[model samples]
Target: MQAFAYVACAHKKTNLTNLLISFKDVSIRHFNTLVFEDLNFSLEKGQHWALVGNSGSGKSTFLDFIMGKASMARGEAYYPYFDQHIQEHHQDDPLFNRYKLITQVSARHEFRNLSNTSDFYYQQRFNSCDSEDADTVSTYLSSIKVVNPSGLWTIQKATEWLKLTYLLDKELIKLSNGETKRLMLAAALIKNPVLLLLDNPLNGLDVSARQDFNELIREISESGISIIMATPATEIPESITHVAVLESGKMIIQCKKYEFKPISFHTIGQIQTNQDELKQLLSATPSVVYDTIIGMEDVSIKYGDKQILDGVNWQVRQGQRWALTGHNGAGKSTLLSLINGDNPQAFANKIILFDQPKGSGESIWEIKKKIGYVSPEFFQYFPTGSTCLQVIESGFDDTLGLFRVSGKSRAETSLRWMTLLHISEFAGALIRNVPVSIQRICMLARAMVKNPSLLILDEPCLGLDVERQEQFKNLIDTICSMTDLSLIYVSHYQEEMPLSITHSLKLEQGRVV
Candidate 1:
């Protein structure tokens, strides 16, 4: 179990200079099903490994094992000796102090669930609140556990290195996804972790944010820190030195990055359709004329001391789709909130939803009836107790549970949509027990079950693997082609945009720039 390595490909060999981690004949089981059977994996002192896999391929479970959060039924795992070996024993050595796993879900949880914020922060967008009283970015950074937090100079240097100096005084909640990620990276660097384990770190970032993070990863690797990251094959970073492909909980193949090539799980062929076929598939009517569906004039939102949106003007008409683009903290979510009637600030803004003016005193229920919304946050709050069929049925009333009968016709329509989405087998299964990819499809089915005029999707493809993403993207394209649904799709990943999106509105620093 000591430091050792093995030969790989000709050019992508594992250098045995120093071993960081090793596993022999590892077997992991969940509910009597083997996740990893007699699997052997190794990590050396200075190499970047990409754990590539599709959804439900157990990539996250493998990562949990590395993080010491997953227990193996049988296996031999090894790590380097730490200073704690003297105080107690090698078994008591802390493995995570030198290892960091940057996951997409946990980052969001930290933003929403972990942040200790005041009610004013969530309820209001603008007010003469004390910025001085807000917890500054620097205060949040100091909370990260580090070996030498007293090293203020080191922390300051890391801050500048990550370009977070301007955000030092900004409230943590005000920071965007990319900004928060940078802050987390700074904290990881301050701890001087020798091995950094990341899970889909690039999933929710825009092009600029992804580039910035890529450069940061290169810099961190250059500083002598080894990195092991997990991402789908389609989204794997070019800097990866080695690659491992997991299939059905097994390491089907492991090789050098240069020797690696993608293996597609399904043949994604071209979608073919004529005008009539497209209309029938999407339930679209070509005869419909254009009309305004959403309007915002000189709309502005301010909360405490921060301005989220400023004098923004936008319009969405019938049969027209729009893509919302921006960096993290660009007020994309806030803008959607205003349209969805979730934010009280919407009442103060000059906004119109489905021809109904915001200040017109429209009931929340009435506004919601004409619009369908889906997001990662919504998935977290979706009712888990309901069956998949029941969940889809609830979309008719915009309620979490099935109270009133949707009628036989409505029930048949929901079943048809589920079948079209290839999830009919799980119709009776609890929505909570379904895989995330399936859950997304179910939510999408529910969103479209009512066939509302407006659809708001916020990062709908965030956690999906490459295969599921492609399937979902195609499904969205089909939805757009066949239906007259006006889409306000908000996503950082431009590649995930639906084919139906024709126009874009970009936001920068609370302004439509």
Candidate 2:
């Protein structure tokens, strides 16, 4: 339990004088499952590492092991530099090593209210009044207690480096997915740890932000802080010196950055879905045929003095596919919230959904029944206690979690969608227990279970591997071909979009560009 237990003198034969971390013959267990075994990895003082693998390949678990959060069944994980720090400052308190020597910016983040309680819901982000209760970005960043201030990372420097200066006054709960990612990185930098861990750091960022982030990573590496990040193979930054590829709970490949070859993704063929199940689902929830799926006219939304969307005009029609393009904080999410009936400000603007004007007698639930929605923000706040089956079933009623008991038909339909998505094996598994990629697949199945007429996917492929991304993209194309489904897809990577897209909308600073 002490930090010294993991610290040992470097082997004379290895001669790694500047080693920061070394894992030898390591075996890790999560519950009864052996998640990692015979894992050997090392990090030198100047080396930055990238952990690349498919979904559920234990990439995140590897990072957790380095952070001292994993249960090691056998072998030793030595921390030479961190041990020195512990010996110098808190020798008796080994448990504080993780807090003092390491900081991790994960893909998921949670924000609390002003009262410092996490009593918020998924829909609260769309409700302006409720969002105000959450801490502002500036407050959240300032609240971080820097353990080892090196004068290298201040709040000002972190914000400026991450291009987050304009969002300092915004509420934490109201920021987009990419904005939140930047804020989390800034918080970690301010802590000034000896090692930084990032899990899929570029998953939610737009193209420009991703480029900026890669540059920042290079700068950070030069600043003497070691970084070990779990990322897709294609996203490995040039700052990284080494690459480790994991598969099925084993480190399969380890080599220098220049020697690593990227994995090639083949063209995915059409997905074969059960036509009877699709027909039954569509018949059960017959969508009213409408020419205009969504209509917005000079719509403007503001939270206090901050303008989220300014005089934006857009429209979508039946059987049309749209690719929504915008950088972080460019009002893409806000615009989608209006169509999905999540933002309360929709009533104050001139908007239409499925031919019904905003503030009409139609209930939000009625409007939502015809629209399938998924986003990174929704995934972060989704209730995780329900099983995968239950999570998808709830989508039929457009609820966050399963409430009412589903009958035979709904259960069958949910199972059908799960099977099509290759996730039926996890039907009984709790959503929180699944890998992030599987969780995302479950959400996609949930969105498609009802066979809704309109599908709004906001960065739906954030954490998927190359194979899974191709499969999902092909599935989207197949679904569009078979049904009259209208689509509004959003992704920072243009390659992730399906071939069915027929229109594009670009937003810059809340205005159509």
Candidate 3:
């Protein structure tokens, strides 16, 4: 196991009166792994910090240390501010002390149904009947017990700040990836904690939402709430006063925000793909060539009185790569569901997929077999019990998890995809035990293992670092160059789009703009 360290920079003149937390020669371990050693850090009351590192570099683990979740092996972690606050106000109430000081909004959230049970699958989001079992955004938010409401963040204020006012009545499972991110932020703010921890907070957000969130973070910091956020170096917000860099579970450098320079540990070299393996995978599932991969005429999707997609007209021809751009709740997911045959409403609409008309004799599995797909929702709800190899193998059958024993050839192909994605080491690891970024890479491998004719990547790079994002983009370009694969790529950042995208479609309020 690799050891990790964190480098924190602070001014020489430290005021004890304003000191929030301090760690002295802190050694920590998680399970049997030594994550950090001799970690010395301090956070003042007014400073906001950003932890910048690659995947599995202990950024999230460091956040856990601050939340008193890490198993400390040596030294002392003193929380002066928290201690004083608790002693001054609620010394007798242990529960209040445990719940009032800090809150964390992780990169991945586990949402429950209205029955308060997590008995749901990945496809439940697309099924209208199953989706209704989830609590509404309003209900979810209202159910959180506020430990200490300082009049800083009310439910209304938090929703308005996160731009979640329109999604109050929407079911939690039905919200878009970006929408769910906002709801999570809102729920955190409602707790009114003195210290807030955000792990990759801007990952799933759209461009506008990210900008709004940065400003909101600034507001929250100004209102006396200190924040420690884990994010990419390029995404460190203006609100952050200091920055800490961690690599290989060790802190290499720390400096003021203005003094910090972003570092790229992984070089963007040419990715060498095994031509014979690629040929074998591509030829394994030969697809029928069609002039129009997808054709939609006056397509409209409605649920009850609300309109999701309104008279949308779009066409995707074979081998054409498309960039699908839209803000949060702009119906981008809904549009993709129609093409992927997940939504039953497609039967009522004049939609054509893979040269076949809707309501044809073709089954949904047949349609899914020809189209490789990956999205944030899929990653969030994916079964974590299976090993990464099993998850990748499941792609061949277009199922959520591996249902039957995979053949030797299928397992070999899956390992090849995992190796190509640089996640071969985790092939034997269960999805639940790895970091979120590793799990995301596994999902990407699953989408490509089948070598389908059409590929739909919905914010595929959501939780990846700068290095992984570049690598995946390069892989996408390489695959398109080698095969006749059509692509419908959705991303908020223009730079994140693959160079293969030659056409674009933008949506606003469910209408093509």
Candidate 4:
């Protein structure tokens, strides 16, 4: 209910070491297991620290501790503030009057103090009643280009964020997951608090957006702001001068500058099979001569008159990889959804799938056997507790993995694919504990195990490093040569597109304008 209480913002610059955000004997637990305990560390101004480990290794839980969202088993957080007004008013008053404990949360879109009771959080969470404060959140969202200026504050921006995080794009009452995260940031950076904590703010953004956010963090740090961020990958910019590493509630490493040994980035791609034999396997079916596997004919999808997809016309076929580039709110994702049969009614007469008649009971689902997807929104719902091999075996079920996979041959084949992807080392590991890049490989292996006929990759390369991307490209080539798959690559950046893909279908303003 209080602004800046859960997460504080930047104040004036001070010596972070002297400023003092000290915690003593802090511990947190979940059920029987202690998530973290006996942690003590100090964060100062201009210190950047990366918290790296496997998934579910208490990273998100650690962020929760600072936000005051999690219950701590034991510990105390202390900050120092010299208040001249308190000195003059009542020298006998407790020191608590001068110092305030900063909360945990990351700041991005609108660097402002946020209150839970405000309509911004309340109305957005459960959208039946309009929050009196909806105007403020709406105004901020409008300014940041997340929503339109002249619309219902609670309804518009709230639904868009819901959609981005893979919720139903209707009323917020229908939210699916356990609380939605934002494409923007929590509004805590404006509070000017003594301590600042950021969760993993860089997880789902595109590569270009990552660079943009890094720049913003640098600007904040250079102005003498104190920041403590938890991330699996060490992305310490030159701005970060100190670090504190926490593991199992203990300070594993703390230093003025935590130097992670730079492992040499190596490219991993192999062509043990003959290129000629591989070429025959990768060839597309020569029966279809249409330049596009699918085409949109002056398609105009609208919400009333405001067209989400304008009269768009485009062509896409095998061997072509179009990045589907666009700014946020540019209707890129909307178009992809339409193609994937998620919204068939939205554009009935104007669209075609693999040259199939789109409207007459035809959908991308009819050709579902041919497509494979990797949207960030869709990927999160994928079951992750299963082993790398078990889930891969379930791909034969063609149900985004199934609960019961019993065939020994399928499991053996799945392990073979895991070996092919160089993930045999983790064949026994849980998907929930692996890194994003590894999880992606697992998913890719799942998709490729069946050798889908027309692979439709929606932002497939997300979370992959340059090495994996290269490895993936070769894998795609090998698969294409091994079977008949017409690849459809969609992304917002041209650079992320693999050089092997040569076709494109550009969508602007809903139509192919």
Candidate 5:
């Protein structure tokens, strides 16, 4: 990978008139499942194209093919140097060598050893794995060469351009999602690939980050580099000159961005929860005055020289639902950890969960029994091969897998929740084999199966498409209206918040803002 980046940095300006990338009757497949077939497309030197699609519509697969990381089943896919550059040379002494693909999944977390294997492609997908050895921001930036030959671009200039100076000394893993993306974009720019591919570049980013990224994209386009990006229709920037929409193994529509008006995106049907039963399961006695669900006073967390949370004060009562708002790296995850009793730091802080002070001799399991949690990370690490029913049934014991035998009543409860989530058909299917969207729904069912007093959802809508996000939000609304389930919903997109969120907590740089 470093060799590829180095080659790109060393290449001279190519003829702008030549085709940069071409796909002629190309078909791509993964796990023998066809992604897209009979796709014919061509990218010019300066035109920017948006590959528009919903989740599972093969947007990422499209980009992976361009990166040479994905296999073509039947047709032809060609790159400049690898195809035309070599063919023009009579298949000898190939001159082209660089292709930069900045995917939705970060390449930062993968072991350097897997650099030669295709398995390294999506190693960072759907989860954030912390790396203590990640290089500091400045060091990371300096490693890449500035592609511009006039010595006009420098590491310092790139840092300023991306608004990443604030994280100059922070480890890559320590940066927030927004910060990480800015750095990734900068890395791509430094390599100066003739053809650049971005997969959902705006995802998990705050509004400011998106603005910064769009500006960067414009700058790259103005510099005459070819760009192919994959994003949903709603997020297609005005900079896109052309748009292509993909459906079941085909390009249903391809036209100029200005002329493309996507029909309203509405999924097949919505998932309806059992409101009456949810209400019963969520029933709780009205606390007499001081009963608290979660309380934290002057809670601070620091990892060596880094501060994660600084004197944060917050409280959750019996019936209140809260929207936790913050940019990436705002300590939202840390705060949720305190409530979920998963962090050892909770023992040193004056935090209370379920009316019991943390570290006051309350068993972790006991505290966990009263609070149900779901997060993207939870789904990523969820045990594989466990059937969807087993995943939900295990919620009864607060375990990773179904270890303890569930009673008939518990089994029935799991089945009911699965039905409400519209994943009953997959009840016997392995959770790993289920589609990502369905897997997330099953996780939600697991969180609701035990009917805990408090619900903590940390960006529960992270991977869901628009329709799935709406369905999840509607379920949350139903639970809030019918039950006394206290909720701490965390999300970067304000629009994804449910109507049940009556209160909000904002965090900025590890402090309550």
Candidate 6:
């Protein structure tokens, strides 16, 4: 389709603005895994669209294609003639500026995923080439809210975004996964693309940051720049003019601005689950309080100079459920290092698991076998490229399938959990292929496969939304009922707490308050 003057584009076009970006019968694949096929979407100058789907649903891959970093193997991605055509007509027309199509994937991976191959003078993975003018770039950086640390920087807008995302303290060469994700989000917002194509814009932001992002999205969309974004589940702004639903990489439904959302699918909208009643029911059952699975008396842990956990006297009673709630830097996780003594490499102050002091004669591996842990950091240490099932199975030994010998029941055990989480379909899928939400379920399944008496979850809902959170709580409640598992749950949201936990262990400023 040729360009039409803008009348809200997408068949609602009454004005003569040209179609800025449109693709037909498009299909894309990442190496061997097929992301999506026969996918068709279009964007005009003023429309705001949401590409909503679950994680591993090729949302980011779609954005990659639009950004010119990914290939279109089986369809046409037609860009409307603007500056190139305008030059042919009037070489001096100011209205014919070249359209730059940028997407979130542009800054996703600095290690190798970046399609731009032009080498820089000074090479660093995280820090890019310095801008043409250092002082000038510094001003741009500050606009994105970066206070230049060195005071010699120039025109580096992206670096400021990285700072705003809390990457300022991290070295350019040593960016963590979370740091990288933050960098990507910051990059997309700063570029101000004519038609911004975002894939899971809320991927790495916190709850409050999400509210900030909502404001940012509204501001950008209000500027009439246009946006096409994908999300699993989030409260979107009222500015979203169109919505599309996809299943198994196929477009199941598509609707116009006003005609959206009255239609529903069976699996789409369902109360599905809420385990608060079961939590209360389980709370009534008498807890064994099995002789202090772990204990700490006036224990204070000092790392170099900073004392993370100070004057900490606590107990992990056998078969008693408890949760640790605090802010991000608060000692919830550091306290876990105090509780989790299943491994020798991990250390803390006066940690005693199962009545055996971790530093004593007890075998660390055996202790690990009795204590199940699920955390985002744990998943980070897990086999990076393993399939979801492999990661889940490895939890039995806390190794990458090395703790135990070759097994016959491993797949069966893993499958049992994969089915429970509604993620059996992703058993063979690579961990990196799925979203963090799915990976978290897989991580929880890995912990569940071992069936430990003491289960420690460190922010188990790292990337889960309301739907997946309910699914997880249901499974956890069932486990609490069927086994003697005592939960040491950690979370930021009280709403996510399963009332099965009768004990309260709140932390404030790294001290039990």
Please report how far candidate 2 places residue 376 from its true position, in Å.
0.3
Please identify which of the two predictions, 4 or 6, would achieve the higher TM-score against the true structure.
Answer: 6
Residue-level lDDT tens digits of model 2 in 1-513: 101011112222233788787889999986456798888877777888898877898988777767666689999888887777788877877577644678898877866788876666777888877777898899999999886776488999999999989889888888889999999999999988788999999988888888887899998888778899998777888899877777779977677777776643122343456666656555666666898889999999988787889999988999999999999989999898888888888999999889889898989899898888989888887887899999999998999899998878888889988886778999998987778889998998899887788999999998888777887888888778777899999999999999999999999999999
Looking at model 5, the pairs that clash are none
Please tell me which model should have the higher lDDT, number 3 or number 4: 3
Two-way lDDT contest, 4 vs 6, winner: 6
Q: Model 5: runs farther than 4 Å from truth?
A: 1-17, 80-134, 139-154, 262-290, 377-416, 424-436
For residue 485, model 1's alpha carbon misses the true position, in angstroms, by 1.3
Per residue, candidate 6 scores C-alpha lDDT tens digits across 478-504 of 767766778888775677777678687
Count backbone overlaps in model 2.
Answer: 0
Kindly provide the TM-score of model 2 when superposed on the true structure, using C-alpha atoms. Answer: 0.93
Between the candidate structures 2 and 6, which one is better when assessed by lDDT?
2
Question: In the order shown, what is each candidate's alpha-carbon RMSD?
Answer: 6.2, 5.3, 2.9, 10.5, 8.1, 9.2
lDDT of 5 by residue, 352-457 (tens): 8877788889987888888788875455446677998999898877787899866898888788777767678988888765555677777787887777788888
TM-score-wise, the better of 2 and 4 is 2
Return the clash pairs for model 1, or none.
Answer: 125-302, 125-303, 126-302, 126-303, 282-482, 282-483, 284-482
lDDT for 474 in candidate 4 is 73
Residue 375 lDDT (model 4) = 58
TM-score of each: 0.79, 0.93, 0.93, 0.62, 0.79, 0.69
Task: State the weakest 10-residue window (summed lDDT) of model 6.
Answer: 1-10
In angstroms, how far off is 351's CA in candidate 6? 2.8
Estimate the TM-score for candidate 6. Answer: 0.69
lDDT of 4 by residue, 418-502 (tens): 7666678888777765655677888877766655655667666655655566677777766654554577776654665666576
